[model samples]
Target: MPDPTPETSAGRSLLLVLHDVAPHTWPDYQPFVEAVDALGNIPITWLVVPDFHKRDSLAFAPGLRSMLDRRLQRGDELVLHGYYHADDSPPPRSVRDYFMRRIYTHEGEFYSLDQGVALERLHAGITLFQRFDWPLAGFVAPAWLMSEGTRQALRSLPLKYTSDPQYLYQLPQFTPISAPGLVCSARSAWRRGLSRLACELQAARLSQAPVIRLGLHPVDMRHGFTRRYWMCTLQQLLAQGRTPMTKSAWLSTRQAG
Candidate 1:
């Protein structure tokens, strides 16, 4: 008979969350939604749109408000990804931009802005999500970039959590937890392509945490090569009987743990 243990249970279940809902490109999300619905054990947090159309070309669908209503009624959580889902106005003028700006940058250039500015920007985002009657479980910076100010601002806010690959914990206060192991990128290199999938699978196999999060993007699924690789990663996790959880659920579990 198998031993009934908490770690065993934790290893069997993990969270798989999605980001960027009702983004400027809804067409890009259809395949992702279809594949996820088919996958069946996952939950997604529809990070709602704020204002960007008036300021830029990016905006959410006109019908997105209703669609979000349905998802929330069906028991999905909403998070405030960002106001414009972009960095602040009069964008940074340097090889190294601030943390929030770096969120969308391909290269990780380290720079930071004051905490007060960070708080005000975050407040704007929070107010936007409130308009739709969506309770934000946490704030995920556009590209997971965060700085000292960002962290301090979040701690001062009323949010329940904040998630980044680097920091996994509950909000108002962050408590670091062991990741168990690293999650490799399938597209890191030609050699990494073949081996990264195997590496992630092995990590899942040995994990003691209740949920394993693999942050993914719709853009990744849009690419043929990346799509195939991600599908395999999902399959490997599913094979281990790991359940995909939304961002809120995943963070909640860690906090409780």
Candidate 2:
């Protein structure tokens, strides 16, 4: 990892990570949660999935509710990750298939959603969070993949921020922390896993930006290779000169003038 590019700004440096806390991804979620808890008192913004993996409106799992409650009790706040953390498209062609073929194809294709659809999803997420009386903050695009229209839709919302690695500012646009290189690619799963972990650690070491966003998928947590990478990355972050922060902490440090 390289040193963070020195800056004159007085804002707080943050690790803006999102956990894909969805079903079938719990194997990874468990370890990720443990890693987060071990950080101890750091301000983390969680993009929660209260309805688990279902694409429709439903209640949360009893145990998941308890886990969320515990996290809130410890000071982490919620960001509406996504309704089901999947595209609202219909079956015969699953969301995962769509993501792998379209979003993950490396051609830079985007999943654009209109303002009306975006707002509907946001409202649904807000309703879930409000049930726990949780104050929803900003939005993080599912899988860090957003279309131009999605970006526009987010900017039109009342939310203060949205994250992406391509942008450098921290307002309607977000300060990005990109992995050193493309970690996951259309390759053998083993190779992709190894590369992704390597990129994450390399990114952690090389981050000179005031803030960096690390996105997680539940699938990564479940797989052994990715899980190993996850643990190693956490350890590396703990070892590095990095600090954890919530959206408010970062926002508070911005120049007021």
Give the candidate number with the greatest lDDT: 1
Writing each residue's lDDT as its tens digit, candidate 2 over 45-159 gives: 6767645546423363556666667777777766766566665543226677566646664222224556667667667776777776777666766655666566666666666
Q: How far is candidate 2 from the true structure (C-alpha RMSD, Å)?
A: 5.8
lDDT of 1 at 207: 62
TM-score of each: 0.74, 0.71
> Global CA lDDT of candidate 2, please?
0.57
lDDT of each: 0.59, 0.57
Q: Which ten residues in a row have the lowest lDDT in candidate 1?
A: 1-10
lDDT per residue as tens, model 1, 142-242: 65666788888888999887666644556665655433323444344664465556656666565655556665555555556666666676777787777
TM-score for candidate 2, please give it: 0.71
Point out where model 1 deviates above 4 Å: 1-11, 52-60, 89-111, 179-209, 254-257
> Which regions of candidate 2 are displaced past 4 Å?
1-16, 50-58, 89-110, 147-149, 166-189, 193-201, 204-207, 255-257
Candidate number of the best TM-score: 1
